[model samples]
Structures are given as C-alpha cells and as structure tokens.
Target: MSSKLANPSSDRGRVGMRGLRASGAAAALSVGLLVMTGCGSSDSAASSSSSASSSAGGEHSEDLKLPAGWKHAVGTTDFQGIHAETKLPTTVTDATGASVTVTDDSKIISAGDGISSTLEALGLKDKIYAASKDSTSPAGKDAPEHFEYTKQTGTEGLLALDGTLFIGDNTKRHGSVAQQFRDAGTPAVVVDDQATQSEKLQAVADYVGAHDAGVKLVDSVEKDMAKAKDTVKDHGLQGHSVIQITATGAGGANSVAGTGTPGTEMIESLGMTSVGAESGLRGLSREFSNEGILASDPDVIVMAESDYQKWGGEDGVWEAFPTLKETKAGKAGKIIVMPDAQIRYSSPEIGAGAQALARAISEN
Candidate 1:
C-alpha cells in the first residue's frame, strides 16, 4: 500500500507534548547551522556550488569548487547515473580533514531550501528520499519513500548511511544530523544555509537527514534568493512594520510568527522589521497577544496561502483581528498568500517569501 502524506497536526500521535517539548528542547540546545558565515555572508565557493558540474552525458558539468574545510563525497553514495549539466566541484574537504568526492549521484533528502534547491540546481531528482514525512516540494506532495526517520524509539536505532548532504535537524537548531550521527557513528555531511539557522527549518532538515537521504534532497536557497532579489528590491517595503501571521494549525497558535525564519528574513530583506520578532525568538508560535499586535500595528500582514485558509481564509484573519482591519494594510487588503512553499517550510522558501512580501507591499 502506498503511504499518504501525514498531517502536521496529528503527526505527534501519543508522543504529544512530551515529544514536542523534547523536539523543542532538542532544537534549542544544539548549534552550528553553518561552520562559518551568517546569513548575509558567503562561506566559500564550495558553500555555494559544492556539486561538480559537467557529466558524461552533457549533464551538470560545472567545475566543483568548494572551501578549504569542505571535501566532496563522490562515489560514496549510490549515485550511479544521474548527472547535472552545470559546472560543480567533484570534491570538498570537511573540517576534520576528511576528503569527500562528489559523486555523480548523491542521495539528497531535503527538509529545507539548501538541500532541495541544491539538488534541483544540479538537476538531480532521482536520488531524493524523505527522512521525515514533511513535503519538500511546495505544490507537489511527497511519497513515503521520501521520508526521513527523525523520531526513533531510541537514539541507537537511527538510520545509517555512507554519507549525507544534510540540511536541518528538528532536534538541532542548526538542523544538522550530527547528534544522531554521533549516536550511530554515521559519517554525515552538513550543508547549512540561512534557513537552517531557524529552529523550525533546521528541525525539518534534521528529520530528513536522519532518514539517510540528506545528500539527495539538498536545496539551493541562494539560487532561489537570487531569483527573487529583483522582486524584493523593486517592492520597496522599507520603514514598514511587516508582521507574518498564519492560521492556527493543529497546535492552535494563531496570529503568531517564527523568528530566524524565511518570513523574518523576507521582512529584513525588504528593509522592514518583523513586529514581535524578539518575543518570537524560539519556537514557532501563534499566540499573538492583543497588546503585542496593537503595539506592532504593522503596515502589512503576510501569510502562507493555506495558512490563510485555515482561519476561513484571508477574510477570516481580517474578521477575527478587528484591530488588524483598522490598520492601514488591513484596510487596504494588504494580505497575501505566499507561494505554497514559503508557508510550509522555511528553507528555499525565503526567496518566495521575499517575493510575496514585495508584491503585497508594493500592491498595498
């Protein structure tokens, strides 16, 4: 029987609050999303195009150039045939002096923009798997085979693999599979991006990598950002207080937002500030205090389209948050449904979020 997508709401099952708290705690304690730079800075050439370009059949043939500490893990995984038509580095050196060769085919399991976008950039789709049950593609649904095993009964039973091009960890704020790897003695490669810095996005990546499909599912968030840069710059939302709110999910946190998330990044990119960002520095939440909302008095409100629908759609948030209706943005209908991906995951969706914010701001 083919497995179906699991709803995020009922995903915890009996593990409920304990699991969430564990996940949350685990997410808080761990660190090192990127060995080097912050969101705005570039680590190394390898950090950007770790995949080697130019394949046997005119595939991604771009030269693979990485940083000093990162090595390529080629032929390590079972990437038998898939190749890209771009120039990617064939190898990278890790911090431990381990040399990893870039394989023509690497198993990519993404929970964020870095993993999926990277794989998509190289045009390698067949090697992807799901360590977690979360959907990688925004519009398209994922299958069971794409899942990563983040939630194991004991840390000992964690999935094992030759190498992983990992992104995000639900258990780790960096979203890396390092701890799980430490438990299992599995050697894994981490590709940290801006999204991985966010606890929510990182945890998803951690879930995907633990499933042992880390390399196959990598994303290219930089590329996505590049694509949306023009859109954000043109919109000119500078000096605006933008707040991102979504409908309450199964957890029931409404009018709340996440910190260090793509939404926050989008707001920053547009020269806007996230209203209650400081209070929302940890886990994702929707408990927007009325006073907090009033204090923010944002100029714009943006949300994922589906999330918008949860509260009877865009109309619902407006109706429920009466004060929002009185705001300049609310009155002007300055609401937007971000591209499907941005609302779902914080990974590569930053670009989409920026675009959505830009559009809403410009239009409003």
Candidate 2:
C-alpha cells in the first residue's frame, strides 16, 4: 500500500429523547427560553433554523434548534443531521458495502481515534464497549481502560470485546476482520476513511440513531471553527505559508500534508496558505526530501507532537534537518507540534485543532 493509504489523515470519525406530560410542557417552555437566551441566533439564524427543521423529523425535531448566527465554515449545508424519529432495528449500508442492522441498545466497539472522537462528540461515549487505545476526547480519558484495546491490538483483541456492533474504517488490515465480525453475527459499519468532517459526524449519528444530536454537534463545532478563522483574520495572520510534516527515519522519506489532507485543509481553513498545496503536491500525503523543505522555506512548520518528541523535540527537529535552521520558521523558532490524533482525524475535535493552529499562527 502507498504511504497515503497506510496513513490517510483526512478521515476521522456522533444523542437522546424522552417523554413528557402537560405539566412537563410548561417546564420545557421555561427551559427553552433559557436556552434561547444562552444560545441566541445571529442574522443568519433564520436560514439555519429553516434548514435544520426541514431536515429533521420525529419526537426530537421540535427540540432540535441551532444556535443563532450559525454557519458552516467548510460547506454550505449541514449534512450531519439524521432523522430525529429514526428507530432501532434499522439497517445501514456502510462504505464497505456491508449492510449492518443496529438497535437502540446495541453495544458498540469503536476502532480508530477518528471514529472514537466522533462518538464522544455525539454524547455516545458511554455506548462504546471497547475503543482503540489511542482514543482521546473531551468527554472522558478512561476509554482505553474501560474497553481495553489499542492500535497495536490485532483482530483477536477486537473480537474479544463483548459488543453487538462495530464501527471503523475499511482498510486492508481491518477489512477481513470486519467480515469476520459479520460472520460471527456482529454487525460492523465500515465508514469511509476519506469522509469529510460533516460526513464523519453523520456516519456516527446514523449508527447511533440520533440524527438530531449529530446536527447539534456539527453546528457547535462549525461555530467554533468560524470563530477560530475570524480570530486568524482579525490578527492579520492570513496568507502565512505553512508546511505540516511527519518525521520518518534519518534521511528517510518524510510525509508532508498535501492538498486534500486534513492538515492542509485545517491550515487553509484558518486562512493560511499550505506550502504543500502551493508546491503542486496532491493526494493525502507526499514524500519530500530536505532539499524540498529548503526550497519551500515555509514561514511555519507544523508536525505531530509524537513526531516532535521522537526527533528529540524542538532542538532535535533542527538537528534532523540542519538546512531547516536557515528557514524563516527556524529563525523565528516557530515549529508547532500538535497531537497526532487531533490533526490526523476529522472529528468534532477539528474545531479545537483549528483553534490551536490559529493560536500558533497569531503568536508567531
């Protein structure tokens, strides 16, 4: 497999309702007013509300409301909302062409940090019976100990989990394992690895049968993303050249974020120009040499925190590529190292990622 296939950073990978009586209606009205005050809409609030209402149905439809002044930073329409009334025992065909039946109470095992992050964003972290060891989210930090599986754990470890449903990417390494799960009477939903931020949110919502929650989650993230972008623009940080690199071995081929990669997209979303895109690099990631880095001479260098640590941290990066010491970024001491999971996956944490990048750019 190509390096891009082995490490496609573009894909990352989502709630509840209840009954009420006439007296409950009065209480709900009071609470709704409070929510409106706390999360009022902006000028675009009418359009967002219309779009959200048109896409939702069922008991939670009435409860689904976008915060005022909401707008998507990446796309025009929010594709994350699932049908509010969608019940369990429904069959969904995943990107792998496998039709899996899911129920309201299904115990799910999540693989990949991308998918796990989505589950956490959708307030369904409790539903995960087992999660990859690398899973990290704002909802909790004990997912690894709770389920007991890591990226190094093979198919056997995953199969050992007491789960009724599984959600993950359909990579060569896991395709057969997913099939085995299905054969063993466990339905596995294989999400597309290249899915966009909105698509990732929708996939998780579809599996959990909570479209309304998915919409809300997307809206919340998009709002944060917009704020991050505005912060970059207001700080006069737009158009700064950036390159995101992943360290290999000494003199080995290094992978850099190119066009269509999550890293590039995130940087561009913050109003900065990705040097990889400017250099005509395509695909998810491209192999580059030291000479290429010298030629591009980016103003900023972004990398995964693990890679930064692997190379002995900030000083080590300069040691790995002495030529980098002469670049504008090197002179300014601007090497932004972020968590691999956050930059590599497209999940709700994307907003946080954008904010971090924006902060880095502003400071630099």
Candidate 3:
C-alpha cells in the first residue's frame, strides 16, 4: 500500500501563507534555489582511496581524525560515522542570490537549526558565536556562555559578534541586516531550507570547509534510512495511513504534510502513507480542517510531543477531537508523538525519527 505522491499545488494558498509568515517577504520573494559549488581541490582523492582500502581490508582507519570527546558530544540521537578531511575555501550561492566565501578558520555565526546541526556534526560547534532561539541543534542547545539566542538580533548584535561568516536560512536575516554584514566585510550565506537534505548538508559543509564530514554523514543517514524501511516492512506496517497535526491554540491548527515535505518524506520512507500527500497537498504542510480529518480517517495520528503535552496528552487529544475516537487510529490508540526538532528540520536526525515512528507502529 505505497502512498501516491500528491501534487504540490493542491493546497497552495494555505502553504503559501505559512511559508510567507515563516520566511518573511524577502525570502518569499526569492525564486531560484541556492547552489553550492566548490572552488578548489584538496588531497581528497588520496584520503578517500586510503579510507576505502583500509575499510575494504577490514582494518580500522582513523580517517576522520576526530578530536577527543567530540564523538560523545554528538551523542547517539543521530551519530553518523565520522570522516576526516582537509578544509578548503569555497564560495556558496545562497537562496537570496548572495555569494559568500568561507575558509578553514572563519569565525561563523549559525542562525538556523538546520545549519547549526550540520556544523555540530562536523565537530565545528566551537566555531559558532551566536544562533537564534529557534535553533534546536546540539550546538544551539549547548551554545557557549558567550553565545546569544534571540528571535532577531538586529544589525548591531550581528556586527558585535565580528564573525567572518554567517550561515542561516534567509528568513533569519532581513535584507538590511544582510547588507550591513556585507558592508562590514562579513559575508552571510543564507541556505534554502526547502532544499533536499543532502543539498542542505552539502551547502552547510561547503560553507564550513567540512566536505568529507558532510558526505560521510549523508551516507550514514542513507544507510540508516534503508534499515528503517526494512524495519517497517518486517513489522508489516507498510502503507499505514498517517495524519500529523500540530496543536496550535484551542482549535488545533491542522496542517497536512504533503509530498517533498520533511514529514511526508519521513512517513513515506517508513513505508507509511501520508494522508496529506495522498490528497495532493504539498510544500511543507497545508491547513487542514476538522472536516478534512474526518474525511481522511487516518490509521495513525502523528503529532509533536510538545504539542501532545500542551494538549494535555492523549486524554486531551481525545477530548478535543471526539471524531478521532471514531477513527481506526484513535480506537486502537495509534497516535504517535514525535519530537518537533526531528520532524521539523531537514537533518540527519530524520533517520532517527523514521526509526522511532516504525518502533511506535510496531508496538501498537
């Protein structure tokens, strides 16, 4: 029961409004996607060949050359194996059409959770000087004492950091702040959050001069994804209809995860069917009404754990939507609660999210 991919334009109006509010007018105005291109070549070939040989012969190789205690810092939530490499200076074309160059020793300020996670994976957490309050990445959460976390830090705060490079989604920085950074000689690279996971990882890696680490992380995530799919198949939960809703205020703002969206991708990858995708909704998520939920009648209800807690957990959800009690999911207690960070951000942790979903479905 593989789910059909939904058309992206099914609920354009709803998704558009959400996107505009999340990213801002300037980012919404940007049309083309950002491209990350390498400028110089390092001894990557030699290093890769050596690593391949060592692994092929069943020998352990210290290719990543990770610093002591770095691996533990990354933790087991989404620990992709490390790969060592030399840093190279490169230029990246951001979503806003701004080109920013990065070097090995650049002082960086991460403004988004997605980029912050990538930097942490590359063992470059110490390089970050500041981040936004919305950043839930390991580096962001454990941000140093000197790091600042705010919704919008304004130009003065950014200038005060004196960072050589700024990495974040376009929504984090307004046009004037971006220009101010440029005027001050510190270039800002605003990544497209809607890009594929691999692209986002590569863009962040290229900006931070950690190409090998990025590749390894992507590979590890891909491998874990394969295993997750197998787990879903083994549990006989393929094509299970799932609907994810977020509890916003009293009414509970319903948004359907459509094709290409992180939630849809994660659900589909686990061999489950996203009701939102099946209905031809796409692009992040679209506002869904109570009528829509009743019509879809999903087999499973997925919501953020925080949202669940806010809604007074399972009992609260049932009380709010008695119609859910009539659905197969509610009758069987199939509501799955996932962390907001795992479902919201396009990071390697998505693999973990998929696994968690599969486990929950199996248990149920």
**Highest TM-score scorer:** 3
Residue ranges of candidate 2 with Cα displaced over 4 Å: 1-87, 104-106, 134-141, 144-154, 170-173, 247-254, 259-261, 276-286, 319-322, 339-342
Q: Estimate each model's TM-score.
A: 0.53, 0.64, 0.66
Better of 2 and 3 by TM-score: 3
lDDT, residue 272, model 1: 62
Candidate 1 lDDT by residue in tens digits, 1-364: 0011111344443332222332432211110010111122223333231223212111111233322322211110112332344223335433233344433234444444334533432344444543444443521133124443434433232254333444333334323344454345443344332334232333323333221222322333333444445555666545667666655421435545555455666566556666535444343454444433443456666665455445653345655565566655666545544433444344333443444345445544
How well is each residue in 183-206 modelled by candidate 3, as lDDT tens digits?
A: 788777766655776677777777
* Tens digit per residue, CA lDDT, model 2, 166-280: 8775344456777888888788777765556667777777876777777776776677678779878889988888877765311223456666456777788788877666555
Per-model CA lDDT versus the true structure: 0.40, 0.54, 0.55
Ordered list by lDDT, greatest first: 3, 2, 1
What TM-score would you give candidate 1 relative to the actual structure? 0.53
Q: Where does candidate 2 clash, by residue pair?
A: 12-346, 13-114, 14-118, 14-122, 41-68, 42-68, 42-69, 82-211, 133-150
- RMSD for each model, in Å, please? 16.4, 17.4, 14.1
Ranking by TM-score: 3, 2, 1
